[model samples]
Target chain A: MKFVIQRNQLIASVQDVMKAISNRTAIPILTGMKIEVKNHGITLTGSNSDISIESYIPAEEDGIVNVEQIEEGSIVLQAKYFPDIVRKLPEQTVEFEVDENLKVTIRSGKAEFNLNGQDAEEYPHLPKLQTDDSFEMPIDILKSLIKQTVFAVSTMETRPILTGVNVKLNQDKLSFTATDSHRLASREITVKADGINDLNVVIPGKSLNELNKILDDTEETVEISVTNNQILFRTKHLIFLSRILDGNYPETSRLIPEQSKTTIHVNTKELLNTIDRASLLAKEEHNNVVRLTTLENNIVEISSNSPEVGKVTEEITVQSFEGEELKISFSSKYMLDALKAMEVDEVNIDFTGAMRPFIIRPENDDSILQLILPVRTY
Target chain B: MKFVIQRNQLIASVQDVMKAISNRTAIPILTGMKIEVKNHGITLTGSNSDISIESYIPAEEDGIVNVEQIEEGSIVLQAKYFPDIVRKLPEQTVEFEVDENLKVTIRSGKAEFNLNGQDAEEYPHLPKLQTDDSFEMPIDILKSLIKQTVFAVSTMETRPILTGVNVKLNQDKLSFTATDSHRLASREITVKADGINDLNVVIPGKSLNELNKILDDTEETVEISVTNNQILFRTKHLIFLSRILDGNYPETSRLIPEQSKTTIHVNTKELLNTIDRASLLAKEEHNNVVRLTTLENNIVEISSNSPEVGKVTEEITVQSFEGEELKISFSSKYMLDALKAMEVDEVNIDFTGAMRPFIIRPENDDSILQLILPVRTY
Candidate 1:
């Protein structure tokens, strides 16, 4: 393989592919990135067992030539040092050449590096995902959906399926839900879909996090295709593939409360700040439990007490209140996580009782919801 | 104890004292910060046996009120959570009141935190350093001197005394030197002194690192006092005390070479970048050795070769070169460290053949000098 490429373009592509590369993989060849030189452009691929990423640079695009003078061949280079070397090269353009014996030489300015390359034939082959169950959505909106629910996924591997976010589609509505038995987060959005509907898939939350980091916040569209055991997300210059979990996700609809004994509307920022301060002492105890009590006036008291280290108490004025007065205790970390996910001026919290789960949603929008199970703080 | 202080001022003082606090200290009281309310202002102190830092905020300084409503008393609060709490307080001013039973109440806006406080009597008292030998220098100059020599200190515990920087003062000249047996760095400056002519002490490098972090970059004077076993650095609002190492520092003056067989002048930045790039491949072999050879013309060849990995070579133009043609190999990391410490446009390097030690200094100044021992390469 022989090619001359722009240094900046190569750096960007290398970084995108490197997100899926991990040094701890059992397969030795999987730690190397495969580079292929073709007539169209150069393709870089990085893969572990669970996820694979491919980023391509075109020969010429929009009156600018990113790559030229190509001799078609393929080789796999160690991912550990290649990216760093490319980033620190002193010239604007980098020249890469691989001999018939797979000895790769990279030269830029007065600096040159020769690295041992592995045979590309030893690299694992990526499964070709072919299915008509594909859809397109704006990258920013997709990123928001991932952010709203990915945090609620179970980090513990006791139940491996809970580590993924449940994605379901019906008609033109797409819903993403994640829960860890203690709390749940759900978001819904409308998107244009193809013929295939009634599709469901469980994608690991870790894969979504890596995908979200590489994706730029733009109005450009990302095409998503789903198969039996794999899913692919394709953009103009990148392609991401992730394996789907093979277990049925637990039913989470029954976990959210349907009725409320008390409802209160409060400024989101004020309540978040109050709970944040109250949790300081609670963190020392490792429980991070805070109690909220509704008062007769438009006021709510948030407090936390640690037996050895004293206590903290704060009061916040709510916009409105109704139904019966109530008191509830829950993890301050979970409350903060839910509050941050809801980007609204005011939030409506619905409480059933001291022991039942409570739901929080935007005051005027029902597209997103968060529910938390109370902790027994007696 | 009671006092109301501006939140920003309290945060700054707490951060400064926290530099001396360590979580792994043997004495439990050392992990907490002592806060004393006095008629003039409030004082916060943190200690870890090796170092103690005290930061005071005056009731009124430069026509601005930082503290008010002070009742003379003192209490020690847990340093782990106090800094975070003070930073997140919601009001401009925070009121702290300690009851007779040592129950501390901190109030800001509508938020209140009650924390258990230990009696200040149990805290370790800072040793008073009474010495007639004292000197004054600009804070920025002192900070620069520490940075130049601290990196060369030995990190191994085998040579306990080498873990500290040797400081010597004579007449009006002060010099700092540190070495790890392989390389040495020395810097000297002239400061105003009183009552002392010859003095020598070794301060632990760890303490200097913490002190350097808290000291601001300014032209204000810092008063330094040296005793038999301790050194104190006092600024306008802070007093930092460090225990001196209890051993005789080795004689490093003889390590510098007296005469050289060859001398070369080069731009500091160009040599640094060349070495950095040449070291990349050398790092894989766990021995970062780079070789430099002086050619006939004003050019130097920098190269590194790893048996498993390939080799790299680059040539850089030098300002001037003289003496016998020579080739030398040394650790790129040590060379990089020495080059970074010299804040000069051009540097003069003197070599004594290929086996003896070499000296590097600024082109025209003698205030700073660096010596590096060459490595034996087959």
Candidate 2:
């Protein structure tokens, strides 16, 4: 096999596939990246036990030749060295040649590398997903949905099913929910579902995180398919597949409070800054609890104290306040994360009571909700 | 004590002094930063066993009122949290007050912090350095000198003296040298040392590393004084003091050869890149050996091999080559470091023989020299 490809384009594709490659994989062949060249384009695949990523570079596009002198063949090169070599290649174009013995030779300008190549047959086959539960959405919307809900997923392995974002679609509205049994984040978006309505899958949060990075924030639409065992996200030239958690995701609808004893509309930026400052001392405590107390005239005071360290208090005048006088304590980290994810200038925080879970929502927008369980700091 | 200061100015000074404060320090007081408020300005000090840094902020500078409501007093606050607090303060101006019980209160906008402050009396006093062996040089020049030589210092404690850069001033030239037995880096700059002649001291590489970070890159002259036990670098608003490592530096004058058997002048960038690409496979070898073989027509070949991984070979054309046919192997890491330190577009590499130490110097310049020992491969 022989081929010459543009170095810059090859580097980008290599990096994308490299995201799914891991050095700690139990299967030795999984540590290598499989390269397959055809008359049309070149495909690079990298995979671990849980996730697989494949990126392609077309031979010719828009009157520009990205690859030439292609001979159809396949081989697997050590992922550890291939990415670095491609990045550091000297010239704009690089040439690759494979001998009958599976020896790989890569040449660019005056540099030449002879690497030991593993047979492509040893790599685990990545079967293409076939299902009718496929849907299309703008790439940016998918990225935002992942960002809003993925952070709240359980990081511990005790509840392995909770380590994924539960994606569900019902009656023209699609929602993503994640919870570690402590705090829960749920986001809903209105999608025009013509034939696909009953789609539910739990994609590993770690997989979504990697997928978010690989997916560009573009207006172009991406196709997503879900099967019983796996979910696939496909773009024009790339495909990302991940194994889904087997257990059923818990029903989280009852965790969010529908009624509030007290509610206040506050400047999101001001409150975020206040919580961040107060958390400096709160971080010493294992729970990182920061107190919020409502005062007269729409003013809310946020404070935290560690006897060994010190105390911090900040007062922010909310835009509006109603219901009853209230005081609540919650993890400052959870609050900060939720506030950042709100992505709005102003938000309404509703508190059912001092001991009950509270929900924060973007003003006039019911599509996104962040619920936090308050600490009993009596 | 009470003072209101511009937040930006305080933040910069706080960062500078914070470099000296380490939480892992054995002395508990060293973990806190001492703030001394006087009628003129405020002084912030942080110290560890190896280095002490003091940064000052004046009450008014160049028609700008940086500090107001100043009441002279002193107190120590935990350095771990103070920097973060100052950085995240809401308003441009921050005010501080201390009660008789040493409880400190910091306020900015509507945010207030009450921190536990230690008595200033318990803080260790830094004695001002008094020495006639003092010289002044541009801060940028000093920064360059440090960067060029400090990386060669030995990290192991086997030879304690090798961990510090040997600084010597003879007549009109100031030189800095560092070596870890296998490789050496030396840089010299012409200074107007009239009153001072024999200023020789060994400053710890770790201390110089910290000092390099605290010192800004500017043409402003910084006053430097050297005592047997300490070296001081003083700028207008900052004073950096580092304890000198106690030992006699090894005689390295014999390490550099006066004559060369063969010398080659090559493009510094091209050679550096070629070596870097070849080192990808070389790194797996404990010695990281990459061979340089001189070929016909001013071409040099660089190659490295790890039998289990693969091999890489790259050839670079030098501008001029006047050398006997030489094939020498050396650590790619050491060679890369030396080449990077050369800081010149063209360099002349002088090799006495394959076994003898070779020196690399900037073309047409004698101020900087890098020498590396070749590993025996045969």
Fnat for each predicted structure, in order = 0.77, 0.95
Provide TM-scores for the models.
0.98, 0.99
Tell how far residue B200 is off in model 1, in angstroms: 0.6
Position A265, candidate 2: lDDT: 97
Kindly list the per-residue Cα lDDT of model 1 for residues A1-378, writing each as its tens digit: 899999999998999999989999999998899998997999999999789999999999888999988999999998988887888888899999999888889999888888889999999889998846689999999999999999999999999999999999899899999998899999999988975678789999999999999999642999899988998999998899999999999988888778899999999989899999999999957589999998778999999998788889998889999999888899999999999998888899999999999999997677899999999877
- List candidate 1 segments past 4 Å from native: A284-286
| The candidate that achieves the highest lDDT relative to the unseen native structure | 2
Q: lDDT per residue, candidate 1, B12-80, as tens digits?
A: 889999999998999998889999899899999999878999998999988999988889999999888
Off by over 4 Å in 2: none
For DockQ, the strongest prediction is 2
